[model samples]
Target: ACKKILISQRYRLQAMSLIHESLSYSTTYEKVDMSQYIKGIANNIQKYTHHTIVLDLEPCVLGMSDAMNLGLFLNEAISNASEHAYAKEVKGRIEVSLKYREEQCVLRIKDFGRGFDTNRSSHSLGLVLMEDISNFFNEGNMMIDFEEGTEIVFSFTQKKNT
Candidate 1:
């Protein structure tokens, strides 16, 4: 099972790496202040179309190790929403939140848009990749709420940098 997960993640990471490479110049960074940059990204996306972007950031913080994990976690979540949420002329509402749970950290990104069938959602390349990445992140749980709107929640713990 672990091998399967790793293989899936490897494929997804390969695609992400290629996408990162194709960009002539990159705007995103490896590490960032959650409050500062999160808001910036929301503002930029909000500018293009009339979408309600919210940054529900908490004062809680994490170390570089944990932060990096959360960054990738959030990146994948937001990227998924940005790519496939299909809002037509208006952009979807995206909400990013960070909070510490005991010794762990939880980061969540939610999108209000067209929802997909969880059971029917094809274990496409992206979903497979997300599953693999979620496994590596330690107790990281993901769920898709497919009622009125689409919401993807990812909750995980952070390991401190040595």
Candidate 2:
């Protein structure tokens, strides 16, 4: 129980850090390209996991606030996959894809590693953060599919004025 609490606290700290970084990047909200930001996060995660990260990002733009929240969501999901998804002997693969359609942005992060039960309560903190962030956008929501591995999909509106 203590370990779970500690882990939850750590995730909270990471979410706060992501929010701070995004706020520091821009004052007034505007549509900004998110390719570089996603790449940067992937790069950072790859270094620690020594795993392959594949990115398929379309030319999508997002408001500063939305970007920050999404960044936080991705960070938690990716980190969870890297840390827990793979067996010690297996080299993991994490694929991230982003596409925009009809004023909505769809982001998918899939990991080729062992999957977990989304209904479990042990990993609620990260899941809660992702869900909360997704709520910020119009018609925003998240879904997790566990087949061979874990696939997390987040869909949200790209309305800049919001």
Candidate 3:
């Protein structure tokens, strides 16, 4: 329970940090450069977890609310991978990518660790939150696969302003 609490707190801090960093970078404070924002989050995760984070983000901008929600989603997904994907003291690498083209966005997070049973009936709060965040996107969809480690993909339409 203590470990879980700590992890939860860490995830919250990460989300807050993303928001703070976004505000710090924008004069209008209404838009966020998602590529840079995600890189920041990746740095934080790598620093504390000692896991290598490989990013392939294309430059994308989003409204503050969309950026925050997506940042939280990434935080939860990566936190879960850090905690459950690999054994303790086992250094692992996680891959993250964001591609936006023609008003379509695709985000992928993949980890090479012991995979989980996707058919399980358990629905943790983190998973629920991620799903909710994905839904906030236009025509958003989230897909999870655990064939060889776990891979999560979120596809949605980028907002008009972005």
Candidate 4:
């Protein structure tokens, strides 16, 4: 009983951390096409897995980081999650969401399946590569939530003047 309670609490904390990190950017906003933008993201992720793919990208101009930054961010995180989080014949789901704030863009990539340990996960090259991207945004938002599933998000400044 105690173990179950601890696990539940851990999940809850992770969820809050993911949501919070995705929203902490203080910057400007611009336009982004969800489908086209996802192409770069999908390619990066696919390279890391040999399984089927599923994607649901919201249709709208998501205020996002520069095209390059956004691409790299999704590529590394999704690929890492795909490789480490999925199992044989146990398909996977990747969800990408972009929320436009008046002055910034919040990007989120979530996966379905058992999540990972953020602390121990940092040693992995995927997470390291993802962290390396952090220097680009002094105030950017990024997070990895490890609960029932995994959710990673990054908030970045708008690419163009609004």
Candidate 5:
């Protein structure tokens, strides 16, 4: 029972951390270079993984609020991949790509690893927080593909400046 309590408390703390990260940034809309932001996240994740991670990004303008939220989401996703996607002795590959299409931005994170069961709820706090953050974006949609490793795609239209 104590162990379960500790685990529950840990999850609560993680959820609070993600919420604080999202709220720390202002919701004001402004032009942001998303490629730079995503690249930075990929680098951070790379530091912890034995896997080789590659990024392919398109130049695009995004609102500061959206960018901040997306950053946190990507951080969670990439961190999960880095920590859980590969065995210690075996190196894997993670690919992150961003593109703009039809007035929407699509971000994809793919990893070559032993895929997980998507039909069951993920026990990771990071994943739960990611789902929460994705919902914060306007019309944000997230998809996970476990067919050939794990592929997560997040897509949302940028807000129009009045």
Candidate 6:
């Protein structure tokens, strides 16, 4: 129970840190450079997991709310991958990519470790929260593939600026 509480606190801290970093780098405080935001997240996760994280991020900007929601979604997904995907003594590789094209964004997180049963995790709080976050995006959709490891793909259309 204590360990679970510590992990929960750590996750909250990570979310706060990401928000602070995003706001610090924004000029208008309404938009966030997602590439930079994701890099910061990847760096933090890498340090904690000591796993190889390869990133392929395209430069993209998103509204503050969308960025925050997506960042939280990412935090949950990546944290899940790091915790559940690998063995204790094995250093695994995780790949993250964010691409924006034709007014749509696709974010992919893949881990080269043993995958878990998605059905068993469907009721987990982390997965439930991630699903909720994805709903905030315009036409947002999330898919998880367990073959060859666990790969989570989330895509959404960007909201048009009025």
Cand. 2 TM to true fold: 0.79
**Cα lDDT of all candidates, in order?**
0.57, 0.76, 0.84, 0.59, 0.72, 0.85
**Which of 1 and 4 is the better model by lDDT?**
4
The positional error of residue 2 in candidate 4, measured at the CA in angstroms, is 41
Error of 4 at 17 (Å): 33
Candidate 6: misplaced stretches above 4 Å? Answer: 159-162
TM-score order of candidates, top first: 6, 3, 2, 5, 4, 1
- Candidate 2, position 51, lDDT: 70
For candidate 5, the C-alpha RMSD (Å) to the true structure equals 5.4
Model 2 agreement with the true structure over 63-90: per-residue lDDT tens digits:
6677777778888888878777898788
Which RMSD does model 1 reach against the true structure?
A: 8.1
Report the lDDT tens digits of candidate 3 across residue range 83-158.
7788887999899999987888888999999977555624877788888889898898999988788999988898
- Tell me the TM-score of each prediction against the true structure: 0.61, 0.79, 0.91, 0.63, 0.76, 0.91
Best candidate per lDDT, number?
Answer: 6
Q: In terms of TM-score, which candidate is strongest? A: 6
Ten contiguous residues with the weakest lDDT in model 4 = 11-20
- Tell me the spans in candidate 4 whose CA falls farther than 4 Å from its real position: 1-35, 43-65, 159-162
**Which of the two, 2 or 6, has more lDDT?**
6
lDDT of 3 at 150: 90
Tens digits of per-residue lDDT for model 5, 25-75: 535325556776677666655665678999999886566667677877887
Clashes of each: 0, 0, 0, 3, 0, 0
- Candidate 6 per-residue lDDT, tens place, 1-162, comes to 687557756875787588777788667788788888888887777777867889999888888889888888888888888888899898888899998878889999999899987679889888898899999989999999989999999999985342
Clashing pairs in 1: none
